[model samples]
Structure formats: structure tokens, C-alpha cells
Target: MSFNSPLRDEELISKQVFERMVDIVGTSHIVANRREIMSMTEVLNRSAIKYDVPFRIATSGSMGEGFRFEESDMDVMEYPDGFQVIWDHSQNQHKSFSEGEIFVFDGSHSPPGYGLLQILSPEELNSSKLLFVKYGNSYLSSTFWKKTFLNPILGSRIHGPCISSNLECLDFDYAECLISRCWPPMASTFLSRCQLWPNPQTLQDIVNKECHLVPIGHKLGNHEEEEWMISFSLAEKALVYSMNHSQFLLYGLMKLFLKEIINKGLDEEEEILCSYHIKTAIFWTLQQGSSLECCQRNFLKCFWVCFELVTKWVYEGVCPNFFIPENNMFLTKCHGSAQRKLFCRLNAIYDVGPTCILNWLSMQDRSPSLYSYLRGNTNDLYIKELYNELAVFALPRYLNFQTCVRMLKSIVKSAPSNRDGISALVARMTYVSMLQHVAFQLMSLKKEDYTRDNNFDELSCLAIMQTAKLGSVSDLILRAMYSYRVKKYPEALFILKMAKVWLKQPYMIHFGYLDTEYSSEIAACPGNSLLEVVIKSFVFSIKLENPIFYIDELFTEQEHSRKNHWSTIFIPPFVLLLMLEFLCYRHVDTQRAQHALDELFDLMHSNQDSYLTSVFQDISWQILGICQEMAGNLQIALYAYMKSLVEPIVNRIRSATLQRIQSVKRRMCRI
Candidate 1:
């Protein structure tokens, strides 16, 4: 019992205690089955779709990065797939056309005064629901009018000259639609304008891959069209994805500290900082040369370092966006009073030291009790029971399920205070259970007796039953699959159509209340549920191939408003439109084929944010060029081919366009 005893050595005691702490946290905190997490995520997507929640729920934040601890809240980002916000130019002050107003156009004039507008008689307008406008003394064909003027906005028609449709509108709603369609120039010019941090190349690649310019304005009173929030959630996820194991664990530890220790005492009225702010701090810290080795070598030191950075940001009331430094993530939310309170709390925590924190954590009911139980060498029966329960499902082949259960138990123990975290945990649990059920069903089947197809069918049915019980997206897809398998084409088509409607509702909700505070909460459904439904519908329709069935009505205008008075239609996914066009061509229905192509072109024109407009713009033009050539309009076809080669040249496309040009030239020579 001398003062120089080995147990009393300061360095030895510190190492022993901290090392045990690290082991306890690491064993319980780290994501063990990333594959299972991913698979379950996919299952969650299917479930979310089935429920018609428009937001595509994805694992994000610390939980996504795999460093999440028992007390760490889950971060899920909802990407709006079907919902798009276009710049509404008409709302920026524009002239409205009066009934019987006639305007002369030279075909080169910008909208409002540029394009030829023929005022249709009230009767004609009422009966046809079409703008029976004559351009340049010739009644413009419906195709030309649709291609040139009809810009669809949230199931409303925005019509005017193609160049300035937003400038003049017959209806207020139409004007808004027209203005929304004008893609913000800032989005395209973001790389050049904003001084992004770290590597511009890496930032640019992220922007190209997933960055979206949201209509949310940074500053209040700014024109909605002028203000677009450059979202970097995708970029941040990519950065998180690139983190090494140790670095991720450090992030997880920080998140746990924030969620449990920091935010715990804050009142509901308080402007509390979230896990995202902590993540932003970690991102900046890593950018400043904090490495995985630094984290591993000095875990607690790294934790304190991250905590210090977060405190500094909270004190300053300015947490900068990782990609765009100009974007202060905390600018709107973090107030002076809150900042001061947060700074004080952090400083107090720093002054108290690690031992105080450990003591404080141990006192909390929600803190991991397993560590304490182990340390006290008590609760032998309880620990044994827990181990036995886990051991029962701890099959090596089904390790993922066990990992999921461990994660779920940790999540449950954490007792998440937020709705999103709880929802995510529930979703994760549902997915794991569904997966296990399917796995069990498949395992029960004799591999030698059943073919692969039969095994697949049985597994699918099991999955369907599990998902269907929840009454979610996967259920609809499975039901459609069953219908298709049984050759119930029309029934399959109907079910798929219903699924598309469900997929689109979230976007519709978001679109309806663009000005509301909860707009951010309403996200378009992400994932390929709608696309999958469309493809399946197309397959079934093609198999049926009955013109009398009016398959075109279901396929072409699924999102069209049912009310006869409303002429507005949502722009259907171009993939469906493209497939329909191909089907029309296959069936030798030239009129419908031309109509489909025109609609596709109109859609491309109206939706600048559509993936079709960006990546597939050239392909769309090429298809249009070919269609025009077939229609014996060589000049129009040539113009389209040239347009396809216009900026953002794809090499293969250039070569193909040149070949088309030469062929057109040969045809011109023969003519």
C-alpha cells in the first residue's frame, strides 16, 4: 500500500481506465454489419414508397458514416425525386394577355411580344382546353403549340413564347408555372461564383453527381426565383463515405456526446444545436489535417478536439457549409443568446474534465448500463440472459441479422428523443425482420428439389408478405409482380399506376406549400419505385397490346388533373414518355409517335432540373432529329442534330451527329 505501488501509478491507471472505456464504446458503437445496414436501407426505401411518403429516406449523418454510438441519433436525409422547384419568372412581374388580344411575331422575338399569339374565341378555348393560337397567320398545329408554349407546372399550364413564357401569361397560375421553369443561372455558374473549400475538383465532381439548387432562399424577402440554396448533403455524404474506420468512430463519439450529454438538458424552446452541426465541425477538423491515425492514437484527445471546434462554431454562431464556406449553416438558427449558453455549457464541460463526464454519464438512466454491470461484476443473471438471447440468433451465416439486432438494441437503449431517429430505428427494425423472414423461408426450401426461379419466387413471396403486412411500397410492387406473373396485365398496370400516384403525392404536398416553414420537411420520394412501376406497367401493356384498352391514357397522362377545367399537367417521367414513344413507333402509330416525341420535347423544355435535360439532353435531341428526318423535315432534323452537338460535347455524340449531318447532306444532294 505504498504511494509508489503499480496500481496507484497515474499513467498506468489512466491507460487502464481509458482503454476499457474505448473498448466498451468501440464494441457497442461501431457499425458491424454495413452490408446488412445497406440491405435494410433498401428495404426501408421500398416500405417508404409503399406508404406513399414522397421523401426518399436515406441513412445520413453520423449513423450513415458507421461511427454511431448507442446514444447517437440517426440522421436521415430525404431527397425529393418527383418534386422540382423551377424559377417562376411570371411572378417577377409580367404582362397578362387579354381575351381576343392578337400579337404579331417575327418568330425571333422574345416572349410577351415576340411569338405570334392568336386569341382563341372563348367557346373554342372552353371546348378544346387548348390555346388555339395562330402563329404568323397560320393556325399552329397542336404539336407546335405544345412544343413551343405549353410549360407544365404542378399540373398547371404555363403558356407564352418559348423564350419569354414567364413574361406574359393568360392565367396567374400559368405565369407562376412559367417563372418556376426558368432554371436559375446561378446553379449552372456556382463553381465559378462560390469560393469552395478543399479541392475544387472534388467539389465540382460532387456538384455534378448530386448537388441540387433548392428554391429555399438564404435571406428572407429575396425573390424565390433569385434565391437557391446549394445543397451539399450529397457531397457531405461522399466525404463521410471516404472517412477511414477510426475517423468515423471519432465522429460517432462526437455525435453521441452532442445528442446525449449536450442536448439533454435543453428545453423544447431552446435553440439547441444538432448532430449535423457536430458533423460539420468534424468535417472542418479533418480538412485541417486531422487523420485516422490521430484519432486512433489519441481517441479522447480527438474527441475533445472535435468538441472544441464545435464549441468555437457555436460561440461564433457560424458553422460554415463544408463545400461552400460562404454558406453559414448556423446563420439562421443559432442566435446570440443560444450561442452564449452553448459556449458556457461547453466551457463548463471542458473545465470539469473526462472523469466528471464519465461520472455524469454513469448517473444517466439512458447511458449504457452494460459497462457498469461489467465493472461491478454484478448482475450476473441479467448479463447471462442478455448473452443467451443474442447467442440464439447469432448464426454465422445470418451475422448481418445479429448485427442489426445489436444496433437496434443499442438504439432502443439510447431512447432517441427525436421523431426522425425513432422513425429510422423502426424502419431499420422492420427491414431486418423482413429480411430475416425471407432468409428463413429460403433456407427452409430444399436447394436440390427447387430450381433457382422457384426459390426466388418463394423468397419474394415471403418478403411480400412481411412488407405487405406493413402496407408499404414493397407490398404494392410485390402485388404488381404477382399480378404480372399470373398474366393479369390490366390488374398489374392498375396497381403500378396506383403506386406511381403514391410516389408522386409527397412532391405534390411539398409543391402545394412551397412558402411554408415545413416545406423542408416535405421531400419528393426518392428511389426507383416510380420508374420501376412505369417499366412494369409498360411491359404489361405491351404484352396485352390492346389499343381498345386505352393503355395510352394510363401511360401518357398519369399525373394529369382529373378536373376538366384544369389544363395543367405534371410532367410525367420522360422514361415513361420515351418508352411510350418507342411503343407507338413499334406499333406504326405515327400520329401518337409524333405526339409522344413532341410531349417529351415539351417536358425537356419545361423542366431544366430533370435528369433528362442534363445527362440525356443530347439523346433526346438525337431522337427528335431522327423523328423529324422520318417525317421528311430534313432542315428541322439538321437543326436538331446541330443542337445536340451544342455545348457540353460528348465525343461519341459529336461523332454520331457528324455522321447524321453527312447523311442529311447526302439526302439534300439527292433532293
Candidate 2:
């Protein structure tokens, strides 16, 4: 019963657990997940700017840290786009933030990790979003700022610093914040600690990045209204990114323990252990570096040590913040009766020993399910994860043309040492961006008679030749979509032919998971190579801004207003390319169109397969229905719409699919 550490004989179990963590961590997928989230948020901010939304949104917390689960709330921080906070009066001349109302950070009276924002620019400012905090010199209030995000309609309520909501499918938590370009003086210890982990480049990147002032005050502080908690969310994400697979898995397991065991056993109000406390423990453990034997062989031992650290923190009544050691994160909560209660709960679990660890890892459904992987064979897990990341890869808004150009310029201007081959995919996207910008210009000008334009013809040809540079099967498919859009049937046919040549090969070029018949083929795909790897990572996503870029199927959904149009609908590259072929052929050759339709039906029908994956399945089916309806096949369109409404898919498109079905029925009545 006195089990404080992994026993000598349990080393075998520790090794097996370590090996299991390897499968669950999915090494390449970890980097891909962070990259995808970062890129996705980048493009989302771009759309927000284009559409005039006031805040730049970023994913934060557990999901932002790169470990996602069914229960994980999608944590987002919304930094007001035009607002800036500077460290001192000397920075008042920092012209880079000229347009925004600036604030001088006043930390003198505030708690260790929190500060007050005093307006430095615009002697007089007025805005409804910020009116609650308006006082002498207009100091921003954490209490007022956090309340602004509340919405009774979305079932949203204040959850600490965030406005938590249960969206249709998932729970979302949005935290309002302001960005301070300079790192805080109190967090300088973190800079010295970075000498061990988070390489020089990553450290530099973290330092250069802005620190956010989240709408959270120290609960015990007097200035609750005006205090803002300093958030190093971006820096923390970078640290998580640098973690080895074992460390990452351990972090995830800690989260699991907090949720399934701790929270499940205690009442909602009594749930004393939070993920942040666990994260602090991990950070403290990680900073131990050479002292801690953090590897596969000692994974369980490391986990146990981290567990002991948490228990120790509870016993001593202090869990220090990772960045600022002066900040006791558990200041009021984990003391006296609360401390005793948490320690007892943890000690009882510790006594359960390997049994507790087994139970923790048993009911998994976080990323890919550690439960089943622990029990069943994992022959196809590698390929399965590749497909999972690829599916998510395609679901972000494509960087707008302007963003691509700016990003390309920034990369070019960066030191040669800073540039890497990863930029090649992005660099080529800049070329496609110019072509895209020109095509949009020509499309708008030649709206009525697009085919007659000589300038459009030149750009169209360039779009065709440069498609490969965009880096996926989307290379051909996006061009084919353009050709079809302009009624260039022969050109669409030529692009489809090239697409078919790529499709016919024995390759892992799928946007979503493949059928069961092809699962083994994917698992045996000879390492999936560099080219396929790039395609899997990028998935050759296309951004469709305005109704002009959308087919008739997606246009109707915009009736909900363009304000919340940041959603990037997931569509598998293979599904999209095939749908485009069907669309193109219907215009040029009835026989070919029918053949394409049949091929699509076969592919969709065989889709119960797990290993071969990606796409917004419902949208893909809905698009099929639209194509069928456009072709005057009312019955087929009706069936496709029905399939879309009923199918198990990622994002629910039920209402839109229902509308399409109703429309199809009305057309059938006409017949």
C-alpha cells in the first residue's frame, strides 16, 4: 500500500507503457497538429481582418497546447486587433502601434502576475466594446472585459477568464485579451531557464512574440476590476511544441488523470485539481532537465514523480506559476481544508498504484483512443494518424492572397539561417496567390463574358501550369474548378485527365481516409515519401472567399450572416477532385459525367473503413447532391441530400442538406 514510486519489478510494465505512448503520441502528427493549428489561426485572423472583425483569435489552453479530447473545450483568446499595451513611457514612441489606443502597463500596485492597463494614447476614447472599463485615463477592467463575451443564446457563461459556450458540436471558451509586444520583467527567469529546452531559435521566436494580458485578475487582489493576468500562452505553446514524444504523452496523461478520475469523483465545486496546476508541475519537472530521467524506459517513473510533485505542492499549499515563481497559482484554493482534501484524494490514487495507471489509460478516446490501442492490434495506427492530421490539414481557411504575399516577403527578408525547406510549400503558395489575385481581378471585370477576355486566358494558362506548386492533388482540382466555373469545358476535361492519372496510381494521396480495401495499401505505402508527406501535411487547401468562389451548395449557408464565416469546411482532396470531375463532365460529356457520378457513389458507399481518412463527409455528400440536382437528376440529388443529412460526419450540415432535399423535391414536383 506504500507505493510512492514505480516498483523495481514493474519496469516491464513501464517499458510497455512507454512503447504504447509512442503509438499514441504519433511523432510526426504532433508537429503537424501544432503547425496546422498555428496556420489555421493565422488564416482565420486574415479573414477577420478582411471582413473587419475587431479581434485576432488564437487557440489556447489544452487544445492550443496540442492535446485534444472529446471533453476538451476549444480554448481561444481574442486579442483586440487595434489595442496595444506597452511596458513604459519610453515605448510611447513605438510607432508600429500608432493606430491603436495604447496603454502603459501599471504593475506597481497589481499582484505579481497581473497588471493594470492605463491609456497612454488618445486622450479621449469611446467604444461600446470597451465602455465598461472607461474611467479616469480609461483603465481597462478584467471583470468588464470578461463579461463582454457572454451570450445567453449560445448557452455561454463566464468561466474564469473565458466565456464558455456549447456550440452545436463542441464546447468553446473564448478569452478576451490585449497584446503587450515586450516580455514582462517578472518572467525574465523563464528566459534563463530556456537555456536547456526550447532551442535558441525557438527561444528567440518566443521572445519576439507578444505576451497577452488576459481578462483575469488575482482573486485576492483589491483592484479586481482593473487587474489583468499576464498570459504567456504563445510561449507555452512553443514549449509544448519542443517537447519530445514521451514528454508530450506524459502531459496528455496528466490531463486525462485530472478529468476522468479527479473531476469525475468530486463534485463540480469540489474539483480542486485543475489542468494548469498539473501543467505547472510538469514545467517544474521538465526544467529539472538532466536531473530527471525523462525517457521511454522511465516514462512511468517520470509520471509518478510528477504526480508526487503535485501532491507535494498540495501538501505545502503552493503551486508556483512556471514563468513568475512569485505567483502562487494555488494561492487561495489549495490551502487548509482544500489542501487536505486534494492530498487525500491523490494519496488514495497513489496507493492504487499500477491499477490506477491501467484504469487511466484504459478508457481512452482523446486523440486516437489509447483504450483500443492498448487492447487491440495497432498495425495500421501509423497510417491512420497520417490520414487524421491530413484531414484537419485541409480544413483551415487558405491564407488570403495578401497574406501569402506578405508571408513570402517576411520569409525572404528573414536571415538565411532562419529559413528552412518548409518554406518551399509556403513560398510556392505565394506564386499561386499572385495567380489567384489576378484571376479574381479578371473574374470581376469579365463577369458577363469571362471566356472572351485575352488577359484571363493568359492567367488561366498560368494557373494550369503552376497548379503543382500549390502542392497537392488540389493543384489540378482547383484549376479544374476554375475551368468549369468559366465554362471552359475542354480545359476542365484536360485538367480532370491529369487528375485521373494521379488518382490511378498506388499512392497515399487521399484527402480523407481511404476505403477498407485500400487500408492495407496505405499501411504498406513504402514510407509515404517526402512528396506525399508534404501533400498530407498541406492537403492543398483552397480558400473560397465570397459567393463567387462557392458552388450553389455552399452559398445558401451564408444566409446566417458573414460575421461568423470563419469556418473552413473540411472536404477531402480526393472527394473534391472527384466532385469537380463530375461537375466538369456534366457540362462537356453526359457519358463521362455519369461515369464520374457512379465512381463517386462507389467510393462513398465503401466509406466505413477507419484507417484510410479526411473530409467534411456531410459537405462532400451535399456537394454530390448539388451536382446531381444541377444535372437534372432529381432522384439522385434527393438521395445524396438524404445521405448527407444522415451520415456520421465531422461537422453537421443537416439543415443545409434538408434545404437541398426540399429544393430537389420541389423540382421533382415540376416534372
Candidate 3:
């Protein structure tokens, strides 16, 4: 289970690969360039006082982290700290308002307090006025009203209320802007929720430090609107700085993978995966046990491990917010089926091994043509089309239509019993039909559209939408399979019921209804009858209390193989059974709860040690303790509670376990 191992190629090859990545990304150069930009901004701020420019520049994003890949945009904010206005009676016969009252001048012209208006040229003033008119009153703020209102008048040189610059350093470019706000302290609630590092004091100290927020506004269509987003760039920088050289190199490699390989050919319109996701993956990976040390030794292995973690998140349809676990980064940005397709693409890379990526990178070094071809013809193709193509191309060539037919036939031949045989055939056929449906739509695309970006994107989007219709059906089939395996007849029957509904109305993938044609095709599929029979049998068996007859019905020979793999698919039903027997049943069925706990523990032990295994063990122990406590077995319950505290994976869970232990001890004392 130790991921850290000595490099096989005497570290020479890995070192060269790392150096080549550095050459391509210039991550270090970006960091230095950002520092130079910060220095220049400071100087600019000092000089601007004479000209009455009231804005100061602050940095955020990858630049704030002190390292960015070649493609990263440096996020800058301009704060309107000390902006004011001057009124002159000689220029206009008008009185100025102060504190909600107008004051009249005594027929003599005098410069207003601070004489701030004297520094601006007439053209600048005119531009400012025109901008104010364009933006209207909504842009004004009470604290920096003059600066906020005058931002538009500042011309193209100013972005919003702050001066803007896109600096070029060592051939890398980053956008900088002045926004009218100072750094905001981190929210106390958010800080409290953060997963504490081993050294809680360090995390506490970091949270107490102030960090700037960018007035980039809320995100609209994955693009920031005119709202402020908290910037943790400085904290991110400190964390990265603390990493050893090897850890830093691996991070750079990950960035290179995201930018050069994964994001290649994605246009502005595409929901291109960002480097932030890769960084977040790294952050999570590092937090899990001693993964950082593992990465330092087995760079390639650890790189793939991190990639797998990212793929797992994508598969689960959730990319958790690194700092805040509750914030699902992918919820709004990516659809479930789309995320699955992404996982498939990444998994394909993994299946081919890291050497393939290294080889691709090497080929890129030798010739741009090879890289371009590998990047695919995205220029004329839509992003949707590109994704479809990636998913299609990533599929193994061996899995052809005939091969699929053979596989389905093999499932029928290897069925454990008559009942299991029928169920297996039905599930396999449904899967095949779904695949065939996708293939049919893909084939229907115009031949010319295959190469043209415009047509490809449109065609691809249609194909993917059609393909997405299968997700619900597929999910239900898998759920039912697990439920059946675990002998949860009622749960399995419920899942099958859901599957039937989805089969009838396949168009209802999300909130909206898809075209009737898609639903009609699914409804008309031949597997529906077989699916119905399996569902009916399950219902009858569950009612008769003859769950054992159907329980032995294994879906396919492959199910035997999956016995070794610990998955959430298995955990859900097991947990459901536990909850039903222990908490919801008319009588607290201690025997049934014990049975469920046993099965869960067995599954956990069968799987390799992992965070998930730890979680499973923790839950199993807690439930066992509960069962013992309810049965008045104080000594056994105390032992189970003590066991629950052993090596809990999640910090939050560990805290809960400690409290539970204390509760158990108090109860035992009372007894």
C-alpha cells in the first residue's frame, strides 16, 4: 500500500521530464514576474498621490499563490481608498452639498478642500463624466462615491474604478486591475468549518490573517459577474511555498497536464476544465495521509494517484470545494453525464499508463504537428463535438458492436441460476441498447461535420444529450444489482421500480423533458419486458419472505470479480439495511443490524486500506456499539466505542467518535 518508492530510471528520466515541464510552463518565472508586477504597482501607488489617483493595486489568484502555469491569468484588484472631489465656484454657479445640506459660496472662487479636482485634465474630467453617465447611479458607493462614479471616465486605462494593466514578463502575460475595495477578513463560520491540519494552531493562525477579496462579482455562466469573491491566494502561496522541491515539481507536472493535454483545443465557449481544479485535487491529495512524501519519491505514481482522485470526483459528479467541503464546485458548471464522460477520458489516459503521457509530452517536444493532431481538430468543431470525439476515441477499439454482442451473450451463458440469468441478460441488453443508441446518433452526424468545428460541436451536443438519457437507467441497474447482491429485496425492488419509470420516460434526464423521439426509442426497446419480469419476481419474492431464492441470483460472472472492490454502490444498501433493522423496524431487530454490520465489516476488510475503508470501519464500529448498547451489553458496547476511536479517517468523524465514547462511558457509569 506504500505509494512511495524509488524511481526506476535512476531519477534521470524523471528529472529530465520535470525540467522539460518547467521549460514549457515557466511556473517559477510567472511567480517572479508577479512579484515584479507587485513592486511596480507599489511604486505606481506612491507616485499617483501627486496626480490624485486614489486607487491602490492588490493581487490575487494564481499570481498570489506565487506560481502559475504559462496560461494562468494574474488576478489584480484596485482599491479606492482615498478618493475625493473638489468644487470650484468660478467654473460653475453651483453650491456643493455636504452632510445632506447645500452651502452657498460668498461670490469668491476658492479651491475646494484638498483641491483634488486641480490635478485632473479637462479631457479626463469629460471622460469621467461620460463614463458616469454610461454606468449610471448603480455603480456609485457611499464610501468611495467619487472614485466609483468616476471609474468609467478614467478611460480604457482603467478597468472598473481601478487602473488596469496586462503585464508581459519573460513572455508570460497576466491581467491586473484596480477594484474599489480592501481585503475582507475570512468569514468566521467558513474558518470554523475548515478541516484542521494536524497542527490546528497553524491553521488558526492562517485564518486570523487578512486576505483581499476581488470585486469580480458573482460568477455568471462560470464567468465572474460584478461581485466580490474572497481571495485566498496568499494562503495558497504560503502552502505551496512550504512544499519541498519534489512536491512543487509534481504540482507543475499536474498543471502542465491540465493546460497542455487536458485543456488543449477547448475554445472560450467550452466549459474547459481549469487549472484550479487540478490545484484543488493536489490540495486534497496532500491532505490525505502522507501523500506528499509519497509524491516526492514516486512522482509518476503519485501523479497518477492524484489524477485518479480527480477522476473519482468527476465520476461521483462532485468536485468538492478544497477549503469548504460543502461547496460543490461542479454542481452548476458540469452535468452528471458530462462529468462521467470526462472521467472516462481521464481513465483512458490512466489505463494507458503514465508513460503514454510522457511519450505524448516527448512527441510534443519533437514536433508540434503530432501534438496538434493529438489535440484533435477543434478549430471548426464545437466543444460538445470534441468531448464526444474524445469519449468515443478513448474507448478501446476491441469493444466494437460485435464484441458487445459477444459480451452480452457471454453474460447469458455464465448466469449463476435461471433467475439470475434473466436479470443479467436484461441488464446487459439494456446497457448494449443504450450504447447502440449513442452510436446511432453519432453515425447520423453529417460526414463533413466530422471535421468541421462548427458542425461537430452542434452534432456532438445532440449526440451527448441523447447519450445522457441512459445515465438514469444505468444508475438504477447498478443500484439494483448491488441491492440484489446484498439481499435487500425491498430496496432492490424499489430501485427496479425507478428504473422502469426512467425506461418509460428517458427524456426526463434532468428537469426538462427531452424530445419525444428519444423517450419513444427507450420505451420501445426489447429489454423492457425482461426488466419487467425481473422486477415482478423480486416483488413476489420479497412479499413471500423467500428473499434467499433471489438472493443467490448473481447478475454475471463479473460480479464475483467486483466482490474485491469496495464501492459506495455496496455501502448505500448495506447502510439502508442497517438503518431499517436498528432504527426503523417495529422492534429493534438487533440480530438484523448485527448481520448488516458483519457484512459491511467483511467488505471493508476485503478491500485495500483506503480512506473509504477507514470510513466503513468507523461506521461499522459505531453501529455495532449502538446495537450492543441497546441490548444492555455495557461492556461490549464500551469495547465497540473504543474500537471506533482507532484510526478514524475523517477528522470530523473522529471528533464525533470521541464524543460518542464519552457518552458511552457516562452511560456505563450510570449502569
Top candidate (TM-score): 2
Candidate 1 residue runs with Cα over 4 Å from true position: 1-32, 39-63, 67-208, 213-228, 353-356, 362-671
TM-scores, each model vs. reference? 0.37, 0.77, 0.37
Clashes of each: 14, 7, 11
- How far does residue 118 in candidate 3 sit from its true spot (Å)? 33
- Candidate 1 colliding pairs, count: 14
Ordering by lDDT = 2, 1, 3
Question: In model 2, what are the clashing residue pairs, if there are any?
Answer: 512-613, 512-614, 513-612, 513-613, 513-614, 514-612, 570-616
Q: After superposing candidate 3 on the true structure, give the runs of residues whose Cα lies further than 4 Å from its correct spot.
A: 1-16, 22-53, 61-69, 82-205, 216-227, 292-296, 362-671
Evaluate model 3: give its TM-score.
Answer: 0.37
Candidate 3 per-residue C-alpha lDDT over 49-85 given as tens digits, one digit per residue, 9 for 90 to 100 = 4234444445455544545444555555444443222
Query: Lowest summed lDDT over 10 consecutive residues: which window, candidate 3?
Result: 539-548
